[model samples]
Target: MRSPCASCVSPGVVKVLIEPLSNQLAKGQLDFIAECLHGQESGVMATVFKVSGEIIAKVASRLFLKPDGTVISNIEDELLVQQILVDVQQVLNQGESRVKSYILPSGIAGVFLEVIHPIVPLVVFGAGHDAIPVVNLAKHQGWHVTVVDNRPGYITFERFPNADQIIFSEPQTIQNHLDLNSRTVAIVMTHRYESDLALLRTLLPSSVSYIGILGPKSRTQRLLQDLKSEGFLPKDTQLQRLYAPVGLDIGADSPEAIALSIVAEIQAVLANRSGGMLRARFGSIHGEEITCLMSV
Candidate 1:
């Protein structure tokens, strides 16, 4: 678990204690917050408190504080919910927890916001000798890893002892073997051109955020061209999401080094960042400022 920010509370003093009321509300369970705290603390301190309320609640039905000191949760407020969504998007884009203040339309100014994201999921499409290092490295980062391969011998428990799931299935049956969501980072390294094509065909249409193909750029292009020839014309947006010739340009020679590069690229994609030297970038390394309006 991530520690609270040093500046969020006073030293040796806990003004707010956060505890999940139910096991269902545990972190990584809920998609978003239900009730958000919005009020003034100690006359000067601005704070926003968020608590999980309902599991099936939509963002519009989620709770929020109005400028007139009203808490709304039961009813849908499209405008207010849209603004709150903007705030949520900013927090997700920043890829970290942060405190930001928002001013209400009524001119009141005591709303602070923060977001806690869930653990990222990594899915490796091949469980070969080379994928062993990748799975181990990703597990070390506390990510949920699912290893899938069509070959029964390769996809064995002994090979991937630390893997959360070792699936033995064809590339076309990926959906039945694993869950693919927006937080999933998928890597295709089966080394079989036919299997790679089939996996890409299935994954490209899904909501997975990152899809990396482990091969040369020309090879990936050829696969795409083949798909196109077969009447599978992926949209430009889907094609853009693909990271062919996966991993960074770090001159990785060994399996472990290659794993490092791939993991780094996935991390950068999750953070909505360019995998570049931070020293060359200006301003905050996190992201730009996210201005939000607190209204109902």
Candidate 2:
């Protein structure tokens, strides 16, 4: 069980706890050592669990901050590693808990590669019909999703069941309201050209990790041209690197298939892929080509 001290439990001191598990041992004793420390009672608990072939990292920083309230998983992920600060907010917001149980996860050795994911947070700009599948895919693929939309009906909790946060507000207002950073991703699939362009214009100049347009290449290009003409030339590499007609060219026509493509691009980007072929490309492989082997 873990408890937060009032001093350290504030709007600060959210550290990423690195509890490395021991290896090269026949005994399973040392691998499950539970340590507890009270340092000004800061609001943050990052627990590492071993499940089968993966090392699950659970982070609880907001809303559902508890010893067993949330967990990180491939299917039922708990930590929003992309939004570590948000998770910290949840943890710090825990205020005072009499009993906190920070349990450790179990697993065997000789498995998957060492995953070093950036602390980038993902914020989906639309809570439309596509938002459902999109958020689900995002969760499974390990992303912190914030579903935003203008219509209150669509932004309801029931509509976005798996969404971490359902925001009902204009895209422009919401874009300026959040703490968007370099590790943040904005997916525009709201089906409204104006709304999509509005958010993209605002976020394009920031340090966002990715900006994916949910339309055709020509349309995206036109939008870009329009924005540039309006004196909003997003000069950042991320903006300049926007994935238009978002998703892999899988000839996807349905919402589900389209969602797949969009997520595919994100996966490619996350895996550091250039969306190209290794044979056609050059020598040194720092992306999908060489990275795949290194992961294994």
Off by over 4 Å in 1: 1-3, 8-96, 101-112, 288-296
lDDT of each: 0.66, 0.55
Tens digits of lDDT, candidate 2, 202-278: 77777677788887789888888889899876665755658776788878888788778888888778656766666
Candidate 2's TM-score reads: 0.56
lDDT of 1 at 5: 21
lDDT tens digits, residue span 1-296, model 1:
22222233333543332322345433312223312212111011112333233322232123433323343444243443445556645544444444443344532221234443456678999988899999999999878889999888899989999898888899888898777877788999999999999999899999888999998999999999999999999999998889989999899989999999999999888777789999999976656432222311
Using alpha carbons, what is the TM-score of model 1? 0.68
Most lDDT-accurate candidate: 1
| Residue 278 lDDT, candidate 1, scale 0-100 | 91
TM-scores for candidates 1 onward, in order: 0.68, 0.56
